[model samples]
Target: MAHTQKLEMLERDDYLRFRLPEALKERFKLYCYLKGITMSDTVREMIEEVLKNEDLEKLLQEKLLQEKQRENSRDETDD
Candidate 1:
């Protein structure tokens, strides 16, 4: 016969805070409501997934390159 023991986990009281545009916040709130999911869990899952990615650096570099290209296009349009 084998015996098994359950492990207890500690409660998480930490918070991650950031700012976003009001319109974006409202959209995210509505999306969560429609999906019947809490905002915290959605954000936590996204964070965990990002942390687990092995190609995060390449992903970040691609994002930065895209942003820079957008900025350049905007500058050209503004000229």
Candidate 2:
């Protein structure tokens, strides 16, 4: 059992603070409260959901490939 204990490094939580319109802020606060979730949790879940989307991932990869091709073409023009 002692061998099962794994050593891990401590991690710190990062903070992000931003301001929104007063009315929107109030509405968001109340919505999260009614849903029984922290604002951070709701935001994190949304970010995760969008990032895990397969179509979005494909689009991002295609964009990257196109950008790389554009850079190569520009380099050829420079030479």
lDDT of each: 0.87, 0.85
lDDT of 1 by residue, 1-79 (tens): 2233222224434887899999999999999999999999999889889789768889899999999999999999999
Query: Which tens-of-lDDT digit does each residue in 20-47 have in candidate 2?
Result: 9999988999999999999999988898
What's model 1's lDDT at 55? Answer: 87
lDDT of 2 at 41: 93
Residue 71 accuracy (lDDT) in model 1: 100
Worst 10 residues of 1 by lDDT: 1-10
lDDT of 1 at 28: 98
Off by over 4 Å in 1: 1-11, 55-79
Evaluated at residue 70, the lDDT of candidate 1 is: 100
Pairs in steric clash, model 2? none
TM-score, cand. 1 vs. native: 0.55
Quote the positional error of residue 76 for candidate 2 in Å. Answer: 14
Q: What is the lDDT of residue 65 in candidate 1?
A: 100
Q: What is the TM-score of each predicted model, taking all chains together?
A: 0.55, 0.55
